[model samples]
Target: MPRWTHYGSVEELMSNPLQHLCDISKKAQQHSITQNGMEEAMDYLHKLHIGDTLVTSTWKTLFAAYRAELAKLFNRIGVTLDITSNELPFGRQDLTTPIHSEILTHFLSTSEDRLDLSSSNLGTPRLHRTVASPKPLLVDLTSTLSNLKTYSRVIRIAPEKQQFTYAQHNHIVSKILSSRPTPTLLPKMETLLIAPVTDLTPLDGVLSLHTIFDQSKQHMLKFARDPNADEDTSKSETFDPVETADKLGVNAITFQILQSKRNKLLKFEWKRVMSDVRDPGVFVSYLYARLCGCVLFLSSSLSMI
Candidate 1:
């Protein structure tokens, strides 16, 4: 527009309201920045969401109320409140970087009072595989944490894996049951037997020895007489399909056994077996026989394949 109508006058007219709005906006921006910084720091300390700003903002007021209540109780009990000190009895300390470093160094010291590494088997080579009770420990820890709402964030740092196999799990349960003095009850023991249908390898031989201990009634009798014998030795002589199936508690084992059979079949050398076969009919018959033998060896089915 022509003549740019009195720019100084226009600025003067809007100055008061504009300045007020500008001041409000600046204050709001600063508040937002401070709130965000506080939230970030809190999250770092607690390792979990602290919830809404409205809720969190009231915590300081709530804490003050609690402190006042405690002070009143102390006064009623004839204990004088320290008016000079604003700090609570168990208040968190404000430490400098160097102080924090020193505290951490003291905590991590290898001295006996700070850290103890001695154990009966500390230097011994581990002969058996060690299965940790991480899941049970986590469950116990979770139970303890459930009592404290603020400490619920610690669950995220716990281990997820149980680290024990089915047999090991059963053994642990049995051990726990045996250790209990009251009621004098014994836990039902079960065994897992995994056998390959192929020729006996060294591992298979070892497993055969295990099976002898697990399945032989004579060995079980010997174990009963000799307390020093393997505790895992089973009392049964023959594998009773009905009783065994009932104890198994899972139908998935059947599927697993079938899958194992399929794997063996897939790995079988067809060329090696059928190389001498000249006739297609004879080859088919021979393959059928081999498959039947494998099926019998792998499964308990008595029907003709």
Candidate 2:
């Protein structure tokens, strides 16, 4: 008999949904699990707006990192997997209707644990027919996340170079970060949210509010640090929590307000910024003025087919 090593069986790969999802791309357990650019992912996700069905493909540079595993898993599952060498998931025929085919049904029927069910990717319904590919803004955002080094936050440093003024602060935060930032996906944005702790600063509810401020959900760490602050934030919570949260800063209430408001603001911001891209460059820094999720997303979710 010719010397031959047996190819692995599909028992685990085919039977389990979670396993199948993970195995969908076989290089690793979650090969296709996007190692999104934390900031970029946020931007792209915003552009997508919530409630939109993401049309991606296993044939782009971004997907190159996860392609093999996906192919293996699909092969194991007995689906005809046709994708490009790069492995991105966008602008392909697979995204078309049939909404009922085997693979199509599998994807449509599967309830994504990580998928934000907040309506559209940007959190609202978009009127477009299909998402286009090679959306540079989305790609750039992904690249930014893939290159993350450390968590970047905006804190009030002790009167650096220029004198402090709201215009300057706005200019500094907005102008400086207009271009997409690069690095690993930032899972915890709270870690990057900080302000200078000065002697004059009162250790009131604002002291450690971002962590605890929960209009809907309680953030234990923040509450433990300062239990007294919650009283004021509860009243401010509303449909437009971002503005309320921003004005209040990152207190327990503000943080909670943020948690509730983030999806909404991201959606609004995404729509406002992506509607035309008349300026073209505006998309890169759409979230320069955003509250959070401004820089964190998969490095590749663009396609125009």
Candidate 3:
């Protein structure tokens, strides 16, 4: 059995008030259906001329994961799904369908009247779909700061990734850039990167974003080197997570040692990291650009004076 409204179509229902026929589906009214009933409903659903828009009843938490997959499947096939709340603690019945401007106005007005009536009793106010539990101020602040740091770091490091491979690099750059209308312009290389940023342990894990970016660069480089590399060989070349973690740990230790002795050991500064060898010039420029800028600036000042 399917839920039927007094209005024939979604458009007509949206234009008019919500009027569901109580007798059509007992399960729909109750917001819980048996497995057999669900199968039958799905069969009936497939038979109907479903278009771009779809509406679905939310299932129990036990079926939540599968229900989400079902929603995704609908989306993949170009259907826009409107999910209604589940049975026990019932949610808004009227908002089961996507609300239009008129429907929104009606709901708001109805809520206002309810609030006005409930005002006499301060113990409980009219709770509605529009209201949500207040989030903790600390939680919100921490989340904002974390996101800001991660995104800021990503933006700062984007140019380095961009210099590696144009196509793949642009994909990452575009995603980070699109988060805001205007992005903070990274200062000239001369001002930044004055010190060797040898300690870059990702905030997340061993397989951090920088590692992923480097992996993509290496992948692009491999394709450039041997365009005829078989798909099988390419698949075989995939880095093992455990092995990568081990190597990253080793690199971190080695970088620490090198950074400590960089002033005394000029040759070590020129030496490239074993993990990455392509375009050592970029690292050298990043590590020493500020020194070059300082020397040039001092020389110019002396010459001008």
**What's the number of clashes in each of the models?**
0, 65, 0
Question: How far in Å is the alpha carbon of 179 misplaced in model 3?
Answer: 2.5
Worst 10-residue lDDT window for candidate 3 reads 152-161
1 against 3, candidate with superior lDDT: 3
TM-score of each: 0.15, 0.18, 0.17
Residues 21-124, candidate 3: write the lDDT tens digits: 11113345365665455445434432332111122333222122222322322232222322221211112333222222223233234433221111231122
Identify the runs in model 3 with alpha carbons over 4 angstroms from their true place: 1-33, 49-58, 61-305
lDDT of 2: 0.25
Q: Give candidate 1 misplaced runs (Cα > 4 Å).
A: 1-164, 188-305
Supply the global lDDT for candidate 1: 0.25
Local distance difference test scores for all models:
0.25, 0.25, 0.26
After superposition, which runs of candidate 2 have C-alpha atoms over 4 Å from their true positions?
1-51, 61-240, 243-305
Return the top candidate by lDDT: 3
